[model samples]
Target chain A: MTAVAVNNIVKTYGKKKEVAALYDISFEVPQGELFGVIGPDGAGKTSLFRILTTLLLADSGSATVDGFDVVKDYKAIRKRVGYMPGKFSLYPDLSVEENLNFFATIFNTSIEENYELIKDIYIQIEPFKKRKAGKLSGGMKQKLALSCALIHRPSVLFLDEPTTGVDAVSRKEFWEMLKGLKQQGITILVSTPYMDEAGLCDRVALVQNGKILSINTPQGVVQEFPYPLWAIRSDKMLALQREAAKLSSVQDIYPFGEYHHVVLKKGSTAAQLEEFIQAHQVDNAEMKTATPDIEDCFIALMKPSIDTATDSLNENASK
Target chain B: MRTLKFLLQKEFRQIFRDPSILRIILVMPVIQLLILPWAADYEMKNIKLAVVDQDHSEYSRQLINKITSSGYFTLTSYSGSWEQSLEQVERDKADLILQIPLHFEQQLVKEDEAALFMAINAINGVKAGLGGAYLQRIIGEYNREVRMKWIQFPRFNPDTQIEVTSSNWFNPLMNYKYFMVPGILVILLTMVGTNLSAINIVREKEIGTIEQINVTPIKKYHFVLGKLIPFWILGLVVLTIGLTISRLFYGIIPAGSFITIYIFAAVYLLAVLGLGLLISTHSANQQQAMLLSFFLMMIFILLGGLYTSIDSMPEWAKWITRFNPVSYFIEVMRMVILKGSTLVDIKMHLLIMCGFAVGLNGWAVWSYRKRS
Candidate 1:
């Protein structure tokens, strides 16, 4: 069975005329799969997690986790789901072990019962278990918070922005621990604003402006890009981009990093691209074909989907 | 029932885990128990006086001695004349100025009335009223001597020997400490325990722990009630200790039933702790909770009738005081300790306190969020 099944979920704040926070959101996660909702701030990732965890009610939709309806079986759902909110919410005055013990006790369980699940994460900061949770380092706090969430041996784990402010090393270590949890067959839904973390998920839902743009494996999303792309670079990059945009051969010109990656119009050659740069009085220019990664896919996906739908129709009809 | 036990245990652990909460709980109560009553009082003390004895006769000297010997007065100076005595009181150098007038012993030889004039500061009506009472008592004692001399003839003085008598009940002295200590103890306990539980959740909300709890499977009521239970018990502990210290050390025993006093105290703690939880649920951060609590506590203590009797309040205000849970507890506690009142007598008070507890707790639990 799917670990989580959310169909047509909706939650809105403010008056009816105000912005709808989550508009008809839907998704499903197979048991044990590591899922990620990758988006910027206000993208409704946290809102969806809230609804799924039963902390919030959808205005007009249905959602369930591990066969328990979020609305009707809220208490049962709370028992089965582990949620690490975007902020460090554990008791600050309690020692690390006390915070852990407190959460464990709340669920009517103990640390001994589910020691193995959180053992790896808990052991790292076990030496400082007597120190106040408030006084712990950010990374240690994250570790302690995670252990608190997992203490009940939940079937589904929801970590909202788990790697937001920690150091790169800790963020890397945290994800490694998450992978181990997934290996234990626990479904995980993690959210992050960092696009780079998208690649680490088994599947990612790219969201923007409170709406899901695409949901697929990271590599699969990248593979959906249709056109061959070229990175066009020159010392006079601004002039090159303007000239490239005006060129009949160039279909799109957008800067990816240090260089503008251009798509050729239908069948334009690299020779034509070089000739155009020269015609534009560009100097010290370089051009190379580049593979589309998650970043490239994100940019392509962000573009208004109207043109892509036409292209998709042509591709489908051709097939 | 089991859920409540679990919640109660959780509240205690949370309170114990936070040293600040414990300090506020344990230390604040003791401080208030010890310090507040000392600053609070009703009796007037240290009235300044200027005495003018124009009749340097032995009769005038003895009368002056009677007034100065009283502990209530600090004789500022002996005025040279009645004019100077009036100047002394009007200039604020004296709270009261006394003049023993001289008829050159003529009034006494004829066995007529010897007059004493006293001028008093009445700017503060209460202080002035007390001053007037003290002056009257001292002059009355002097007049008793005057009246006794004429009594040898056994003539009619109609007012002479009216047989003065006074009976003071329970706390005849009514030491302010006895009244204040109990009220302060209740205030401190409520301030500490309720914040410990309620603020923990709000703090979590602020730092994001509440969001984490929201996504968890913990029942909302269990989580909330669990938090409230520990603080409630801690409040009980503080109250017990406060009662022990005051009763054992200060000899301020309650005249009412011991069981009734404690039961009322427990019921009242619920109202206070519930109030704290209610404030926490509505607040967004620890700071907001702390500030709002401090403000609410101030209003509860001041308006709670700890400083003055609520009965003296205007009719509308006296009615408003009925809603103050602290006032009910104070009234009940004083009645039980000072008057030795029965449970049947204070049943109405207990019922009102129960209403406060149940009402505030319901409001607190309702304001609390089960979801994001």
Candidate 2:
């Protein structure tokens, strides 16, 4: 059975009319699978996680966690699922031990019963157990939150933007902890805006503007980039970007650290691109055929959807 | 039941972990209860009086002495002109002016009557009114004495005398502290109960911890109860401290048994804490919750008859006090402590408070949405 399933979920906020925060969002996580939702801020990732965890209700859709309906069997689902919100939300004044004990007791379980599940993460922060959560570092706080979320031995865990603001080392260690949890057969659905983290997930759904742009394995998403891409570099990257945009054969130009990923117009070859760069008086320009990564795919998928939304908005204003 | 216990444990830990909240809950009430009663005293005394005696006759002088000796008035100015005396009132140095006409003694002997005028600074209306009444009583006594000496009436006569002797019950000396201490105790309890719980829940929302609790399996009633019980316990502690202060400093012992006061207080705390939770559930942040709670508490304390009598309030205000839970508790506290009222004696108040407890808390729990 699928550990979690969502069908045709739609959510809108505001009172008088509405603003769509999520539109027809649907996905399924197979039992013991790790799924990631990749999106920027305000991409409705938190709203989706809230709906799936039964903390909010979708306007017109259905979801089930561990075979329990999101609306009807909310009690059972709440017991079986763990939710760590986008914000670090444990009681700030409470000591680490107190926070862990509180969450465990609320779930009708004791720390002794679920000690093994959180032992790996908890051991690292054990020396700071007596300190208040507000006094802990960002990484320690995240670990403590994860420990509290998992103290009940939940079947599924939902983490929203868990590593949005942490040191690079902590973010890497946190992912390792998650991988360990996934190995124990717990379904984990995590969301992050970091494109590099997408490679770690078994599968990923790229979301933007409350819409799913694409869903596939990280490698699969990269493999499906429709256009032949090139990385172009010069001494003056900004000036190079401006001059390259003026090229008639250039389809698109996006700055990716130390280079720009340029898609050529149809029937435009690399020899023509080099000739255009030379003709534009660009010095020592280097160009190479490049493989499209998830970042390239994300920008490629996001641009047109934004254009269509803006087009509709303009269309509405004209009326 | 077990869920409630665990939730309450979490709540208590959070409440005690903060030193500031501990001071507010445990120490602030003791200081307020100790100090507030002294400021809230309503007895009017030491009223400054200015006598404008133009006649300078025996009757006028006698009246001036009687007024000055009444212990309620202090002679601030004794002038011959109304303008001089009015200046004293203008400077706020005198609260009342006793103006005697030029022919005051001559009129009493020839016309068999005399008229005296009083001008009072009514800005502090309560003080002015009480001072005027006290002066009037002293003048009445002087009139009777003069009448007895002037008209030599026989001790035995055909006329029958009907005298009215009044006695005070509950508070023989009419000590304002006796009335104010219990009422202030009620206000203290309401403040600690409402403001604390209101801020408590909204702090969770502001800090984003409420979302973590919302995703748990805890029932809404259990959450509300968990939030309420800790503050409810704190409120009772405040009440006990207030009562102890009243007893130790002011020598106030409840005329009724302690059980009656606690029984009423427990129910009152439920209603008040329920109100706090209601405000918190509706507010999105701590500032809104604090402002909303302040607005409601101002209305509650004013209409609760802490400083004024409900009977003297306008009809509409009295109607509002009927719905005010603080008013009921204040009245119950006064009745139980001052008047020695038992449970049976205050059954109506107890029932109304219980109704408020059930109705307000039921609405609060219903309005608290776990899935919002």
Candidate 3:
């Protein structure tokens, strides 16, 4: 059974000449599967989560959560779905236990009834249970919010950028908790800007500028890279990028940590490009043929959209 | 019902946990209730008077002495020249100038009547009007006394007389505090109900917890009721504290039954709290909610007849008061406390308050959207 199904959803904001926040977006998450909507900031991931959770109305389209219509059956969806928004949204003044109990009681359940679901996360924060949520560190607050979202044992969960601003260790622990929850057969839809987190999901839909660039498994997305990518490094990386942009065969150049990931045009060889750079009197430039990751594909996908946006902006400016 | 109960528990916990909010809810109203009534009194006293007595006769002297001894007027200046007395008025030393004509004691004996000119500063119209009327009453009494002495009539006199004795009801001493305390109490209740509830949901929005609550299965009316009930109870508690202070400090006991006052207060809080929720629903942040509540409160207090009589207001202002819930509560409070009016006496006000409670709460519930 599909836990969430969205089709042709479009949302726009502003008073005049509305700017589209989501444009004809369509995706689905199957039952008990951990699905990830991967994107950078302002990529409409939050908008999609809001629509699926029935907190906002889509301009045009239909969605369902746990087989209940988002609009027509919102009350039912609200009962069965759990949502932890992008921000830490639990009552900051409320203690950890109070926050947990409040959420449980509001859903017509008790803390004891769902103790098993949040027991793991709750135990870690139990020592500081009397502390206010605002006083907790980032990791503890994240866990408390997650526990609140899961208190009623929701069938489906929507977490929007759950791991953003969290330290590396907590982010890892949070995903481990999510994996454990997935083992209990809870369908999860999580959005994150971290490209590394994308690999942990069973399936991910790469979103950009209110449109989905691609939807595939982690290996499939990396397998579909059509370019012979190369990682090139030199003492002066900025100068290297500037010089490489002048080459006719270089399609894109982006800085990735110590090396710059370069995508060449069709029919261009990395060996040919390496020898060509060596002949240019560049100082100790090193090059190697590299396998493309999700970040590479994400950047590659983002280029055309950015280009089209600027082109339309130019067209409108000329008029 | 269970959802509402849980929501109320959360609300109460949040309310009582914060020290600042507790101070605002409990301590602030008591302080305001104690201090406001003494400052809000409208009874005018200590009118400064300057008498320009050009007539040196015993009758003129008697009139001047009567004016000075009326207890409402203080003789600030005694001068024979009207110009000097007018100078005292100009210097702000006198509020009223009495100009007695220069008759040398012959005009009143020869002619049956004498004319006197009284000049008063009318800047504060209420004080001026009341002072003029008080002086006129004292002069009228003196005239009657003089006429009775001159007549020396037998028991078979031809003239018919009617003596009028007037008494002030409800507040026989005409204590302004008796009237002002209840009005100030209504205002305090309104401040608690309107301002605090206005900030309630908006604060959740600011802190982003509203998003979590909105995504739940709790009904809209349940959410609104949960938000309202805590403040409603707090409002009653504040009213009770205010009533206790009024009795202890000001020695005011309500003429009507406690049941009637509590009943009206309960319904009035519903209307005011519904207004607060309506404002919060329309606002995007706590600042906007605060500003809108303040704007509405100014209108409610001014038109609610707290310090002024609604009957004496302009026709349009009077019309506006008809729809003001605060005005209805103030009116009901005064009628019940001062006049000992029964529920039947305030049935119209109660019905209008019921309409306000229904309409505002319904609008609040309808305007609160889980989806935008």
Candidate 4:
């Protein structure tokens, strides 16, 4: 079953003509699937989440969560869905237990009644249950917020950047909790700016500028990278990469921290690359192929279509 | 409804667990109830008085002694000149000064009606007005003394055939504490519903946790009702405590049904909490909600007949008070406590309060939006 169905969603904010937060976007998530929308800040990820959660009305499209229309059936849908926003959202003044109880009470359930679903996660912070949520460590706060969100065992959970600012250990634990939730057959739709986390999702959508650039499994999208990519290291990495870029055979050249991750023309021979490097006298230069990940595919797919279209067409044409 | 009950329990727990909030919610109102009435009385006493005795005569000396011996005035000093005496009053050193002219005794002996000047400070106009009347009563006594000793006149008292009667309502003790405690309960209940509830919701919006609530299967009404119910229950708890303090400290119990008061107050709390929710729904942050709710609170209390009697207010202000729920609560509380008024007897006030309770909540619910 399609757990979440968003069709041609558009969210335009403010009265001014230029403020279009979300352009036409559409996607679907199957039941029990962990779907992720990976994008940088201001990519309309939050706006899309708001629309799906029925917190906002879309300008010109329809969305349904668990087969309920986002707009019309908002009330019925609200009871079956859990949402954790991009920012920490709990009563900071209230203790962890108080916050948990307050949220549980709103859902007409007791923590003990639904303890099994939340026990593993809640127990981690139960020691600090008497401590104010505001004063807790970031990791503990995230856990408390998640436990509160899932206290009623909603069928589908919507997490908007749940791990935006926490230690790596907590972020890992949070995703693990999400995976544990998925095991219970809870459908999850999470959005984040972190690229590494994208690999953990069952399916991922690369979104930018209020548009989805690509939507596929992490490996599927990455395998579609149509280039011979090489991580080139040299004594003068910057100068070497710039000199390598002068060769017509080099398709794209960009620095990747200490070294440069360079792309070559499709189907170009390794012999074509060796001759060019020797001509440039790029001292102590080493070029070897590397596998493409979601970030690589994301950056490749996010390029203006006109720029990448010719190369994609040429790569397919030669095939 | 079950959710509401649970929310209410959570709210009570949170408020009780925080000692500082407990102090503000419970102890502070009791202190105000105990101390404020005594501090705010309109009755004037312990006045500082000076006499400018220009005439060095027995009658003037006797008059000065009489005025000094009066407990109302504490003959602070003797002024050498009229200007200095007037200056003393302007400086607020004396509440009043008696200016005795050079021929003051001669005029009193010869003239049937002699003018004795009593200059009173009138900053607090009502107290000043009453003080002048009190001084007149003392002067009348002095006149009777003078007439009886000098002329040997038969006293024909006007009160021989007339009947004077009066009775105090609600609080026969006339202890201002009795009146104030109920008023403080109203204030405390309003603070919980207005300040605390408003901040609570706005705090969620500020931190973005409202999104979590928004995405939950909990209905929007559930969300709004859940938040409001807890504060409403807290308001009731504070109300009960405040009422208990009033009864404990001053033995002032409401003559009306306590259950009826609680019921109406509970219904009225929906309106108060609704007001706070309306503020929270519109505000972007807790600070704005806190400030806006407090500002509205100040205006409501000022016009609520808490400090001033609505009946004594100007017609325009009286009309304004008609729309103020606080005014109705004050009137109903005073009526029930003082006159043993039944709900049926105070049906008009109850109707107005019910209407307000519905109207404010409607406004609150309608004003609440899904997003800021």
For TM-score, the strongest prediction is: 2
> Interface RMSD in Å per candidate, to 1 decimal?
2.6, 1.1, 0.8, 2.4
Better of 1 and 4 by DockQ: 4
Q: Write model 2 residue lDDT over B281-349, tens digit each, in one string.
A: 899998899899999989998999998899999999999999999999999999999999999998999
* Candidates 1 onward: DockQ, in order: 0.48, 0.70, 0.72, 0.49
Considering only chain B, report the TM-score of each candidate against the true chain B: 0.84, 0.95, 0.91, 0.88
Model 3 TM: 0.90
Residue A36, candidate 2: alpha-carbon lDDT: 94
Model 2, A212-254: lDDT tens digits are 7777889877876666689988878888898888777777898
lDDT string for model 3 (A24-101, tens) is 988788999999999988999999999999999999999889999999999999999999998999998899999998
Candidate 4 global CA lDDT score? 0.79
Candidate 2 docks at the CAPRI level of medium
Q: For model 1, what share of native contacts is present?
A: 0.73
User: TM-score, chain A, per candidate?
Assistant: 0.91, 0.93, 0.93, 0.93
lDDT of 3 by residue, B1-372 (tens): 888888998899999888988898778878888888877768667999989889878998999899888788999999899889989888889999888889935776778688888899998788899899999989889888888878878878778778789999899999999999899999999989998998988999899998999898888888888999999999999999988998999898889988999999999999999999999999999889999999989999999999888999999999999989999999899898889999999988999999999999999998998889
Ranked candidates, highest TM-score first: 2, 3, 1, 4
Q: Compute the lDDT of residue A214 as modeled in candidate 2.
A: 75
The predictions' CA RMSDs to the true structure, in order, are 4.7, 3.8, 4.4, 4.8
**Residue-level lDDT tens digits of model 4 in A32-80:** 9999999999999999988887888898989999999988988878788
> Model 1, B228-302: lDDT tens per residue?
667677778887888887887678777766788778878888888788788888888888988887786676677
TM-score of each: 0.83, 0.94, 0.90, 0.82
Sliding window of 10 residues with minimal summed lDDT for model 3 chain B = B104-113
lDDT of 2 at A216: 81
